[model samples]
Target: MAPTLRLLAAELARRCDQDGPHADGTGTGGVAEMERAALLPPGKLLRPLLFTESAAATGMRRADTLAAALGVERLHVGSLVHDDVIDGDTQRRGRPSVVARYGLPNAIVTGDALLIGAFREVAAHTPASVPDARRLAVVQTLAEAGVDLCRGQAMEDELRAQGDRDVDRYLRMISLKTGALFRASCLGGAQLAGAPAAAQHALTRYAEHLGRAFQMADDLLPHTSDTATSGKSALSDLRNARPTFPVLLCWHRTNEQGRAQLSALLAGTLPAETAMETLRVLLRESGALTQARAAARAEAAQAKAALDELPATEARAALHAVADLAVDRDR
Candidate 1:
């Protein structure tokens, strides 16, 4: 990990430990304990890293910037906890999920507590140089992103129920579900730094593209990587009857027979393992996998292009590397 990422992780762990209701020793202790476990290992730390690097690129590095980074990460972890409960996922990052370790109620409460803790962490931020109004803007950015995330998730559920396969719709859903937070991370970092509006807009666009690429790559994982490599169950999306990028691309490109197979698989009429194999073969043979990969690469390219507006700095270079990692990683 980069030094900045390490710093962000350490600070995030410290914030998680120090804030919230942990001191009460009541049931809140359980929430705090779960928060530490969920956040401390700090999978990727991409959101915080994005925020920190964005701040650095804008020539602003403060304790409050780190706090804002932690705030985005907390929101992310809370989303994951709630997602696990909704998806009935028993595992995350190769360990039992919060819902699996504790009961559903605990997982839900823990997720809510994390969100509250995120606000508390942000509220406590008082950068000596930054004004209170700017700090409040950061908080508002987070709040709006949270709303977008919930709207995205709800839209996704509705789409899944309708068996929607439109690529445009899928992109819009992911823009909200995944891209919103990425946007917030970059925007909040810039806001904390009191960056000019143009720079902030550029970073926001960069984050949007990066987030789309990140999710596109994630949608490919079930078919391209195994459980150990991906840190997720193989064909888990298929089992849940969710339509991902590769699946939708395959649907668009394949023959009528292939479409029937996909429909059966998605409708739960076909056996899951058999459907998974059939879809994988269809995706690979029909050029959907290549197309999906191309789409991810295109998005990453656009993300990098958005950075052209920023000053050339090591922090900007770090952001470039993050865009690469967004699509290149297996997990």
Candidate 2:
């Protein structure tokens, strides 16, 4: 890892692990443990890093944003807990999901606790050095992003139930589901720093494009990697019948007869094992994989371009590298 990234990771490990509320008056501690399980061994720490980096790019002190960064990460983890419950995914980052290890009720409570804790992290934990107005803006930004996330999740479920396969709508949904939080992390960092409007917009744009690329890359994970490598069930997307980008791409690129079979497969008319195998074959042969990769790259390129609006700082340069990583990473 880069020196800056390594330091940030260490900081996050220390700060995030100790921040959860223990026992909530009942002294049960189970909810806190579930929250710990969901958070410890943090994956990527992408949002917090982005938060700190975006703040740094504004010539602000990175250390001052630590509480807010922690808040954003908690919000992210909370959302992931909900995602696991919604998808019935038993695993995450090679560990049992919060819902899997703890029952659904505890998982829900854990998620809610994290959500409540996240707001407190922002409201009560921010340094006195941060201005009141800017702090309010940051809070509003995170709240709005959280709303977008919920909307996006609902949109995804609607797509699955209605079998709506519009690629444009899919992009919008992912932008809301994924990009909104990225925006909050980056935008909130800028807000905490009292950054000028222009810098905030540029950083937010960069984050949104990076987020789109990241999600596109994520959609490719099951198609390209095994459960061990991807750290999740390979058939998760197909099992949910979630209309992911590559799946839609494959649908659009294939012949009419292939489309018919794909529909039948999605509808469970065909044997699941056979459908999974056939869909993988079609994704490979139909050029959809390559096309999907290209789209992710394009979004990454846009993310990099957005950095051009910022001053030539090392922090901005790091953001540029992260954009490439978003698309090029395997997991």
Candidate 3:
């Protein structure tokens, strides 16, 4: 891990590892325990890394962004908890999901706790060097991104239900669901450091593309990578009938006969094994996975290019490295 990331790991432990009493002065609720499982020694910690490196790129010390970084990580894990419940996913990061271990109600509460607690963490733990107004701005940025996350998830549900495959709609949904939060990570860091508008804009652009690239690679994992690497079941997207990047790309670019067959496969009209095999063949023959991979690389390149606006620094290089890491998940 990077030195800054090591520092972040320690900060996460110090802050997020606590187990306080529940309401009515009762003993610690298992919620705290569940939260610890979700957060401690976080996997990848990419959002936190983005926020901190963004601050670093703005000439702030790495340590100063710890609160901001952990806050985002908390929020990210909360979303994942809720996502596992919604998707009926039993596993996360090669372990049982919160819902799998704690049951649905407790998982729901755990997610809500972290989702709201993250905002509190930011509001209460901001560095003293940051002015009140910028602090408020960071909180506002996070709140708005949270709202966008909901909107995007709703949009994704609608698209899947209606079997809509417009490429632009898919792009817009991801920009909201995935890109908004990623953008917030960089924006929060820049805001904390009192960065000028131009620098903030550049980092925002970097994060936006990085998020898209990340989601694109994620969408491809079922098709291109092993189940162990993805930490999810095989052909998970197909199982869920999600209109992911490669799916929509194949839909848009395939011929009429292929579209008819693909639609049948996605509509769950075909036999399970047959649909999986035929769709896999369709995806390969259409080159949708290759196209999606190229698109992911393009977005990563755009994220790297956005760094040019910032002054050359180790922090900026770290930001570039993160952009590469986003797409590297597929490998």
Per-prediction TM-score: 0.96, 0.95, 0.95
RMSD of candidates 1 onward, in order: 1.6, 1.8, 1.7
Candidates in order have lDDT scores of 0.87, 0.87, 0.87
Q: Write the per-residue lDDT of candidate 2 for residues 1-331, one digit (tens) a residue.
A: 2755676667667764565554555423566667778888888888888988898999888778878888898999999999999989999988899999998999899999887777888888888988889889988999999999999999999999999879999999999999988999999988888889999999989988999999999999987878887788887888888899998998999999889877987887766677889998989989999999999999999999999989998888888888988988767
RMSD of 2: 1.8
- Candidate 1 lDDT over 104-213, as tens digits, reads 99999889988877776677864656788888898999999999999999988888999998999999999999999999999998988889999999999999999999
Best by TM-score: 1
What's the distance in Å from true for residue 92, model 1?
0.5
Q: Tens digit of lDDT per residue, candidate 3, span 81-156?
A: 9998988888888778899999999999999988898788788887787788988988999999999999999999
Segments in model 2 whose C-alpha atoms lie over 4 Å from true places? 16-28
Candidate 1 stretches greater than 4 Å from native: 19-28, 62-64
lDDT of model 1 at residue 173?
95
